[model samples]
Target: MTPRPRKQVLLRLDPAVYDALARWAGEELRSANAQIEFLLRRALGEAGRLPGAAGPLPRRGRPPKNPGGDTPADE
Candidate 1:
């Protein structure tokens, strides 16, 4: 599947708001940008404002070489 291109947005937040968002994002183990996107998606879903179905999210980070070949049982 072709990856969807993300839109670049410019957002302005108060200093305190930014700090709070950063802290919360850290706690959730997500970057501030990802945390913000997550929140926006949820809010849109709740408000019934979401666009047509989104494709499944692509897995983050590098894909494993040899797929499941790293397990001890396979060694």
Candidate 2:
């Protein structure tokens, strides 16, 4: 499956706000950018403003191969 594209945004925050966000993000074990996205999703969900179903989470790493796997004749 093709990967979805992410929109790049330029957000300007006050230094104090940025510092607070960085601290919070570290506490949550997420990058500052990821933390922002997480908070936005939560707020949107709480406000009943989320669009569409969350959908299946993207698979991690390589796709699993068939259990009855094929081996190359050379092997």
Candidate 3:
């Protein structure tokens, strides 16, 4: 199934929490936003709130399979 488009979200985290997230992101080689998404997915998965297999939320974007079976060079 195709994934849905992403919507912009604004979160107001405490200063300390934001700082810790930034640090964790650096350590994990991920952007702060990515880290936050990962954390949220993990939490949701643990709580069985994920849509399927109790897995992390799917990343928002098209899947790798090309509907027309075309390669990058075809375009």
lDDT top scorer: 1
lDDT per residue (tens digit) for residues 1-75 in model 1: 556887799999999999999999899877888888888888888999978766544455577776647764557
Q: What RMSD, rounded to one decimal, does every model reach?
A: 3.6, 5.4, 4.5
Error of 1 at 35 (Å): 0.5
Q: Candidates' TM-scores?
A: 0.74, 0.68, 0.65
**Model 1 steric clash pairs:** none
- The sequence of per-residue lDDT tens digits that candidate 2 reaches over residues 23-66 is 99898777788778878888888999977756433343456564
Give a tens-digit lDDT track for model 3, residues 2-72. Answer: 45666689999999999999999899877788889889888877998866744344544566676556686
Error of 2 at 41 (Å): 0.4
Better of 1 and 3 by lDDT: 1
| Runs of candidate 1 exceeding 4 Å displacement | 56-75
Worst 10 residues of 3 by lDDT: 53-62
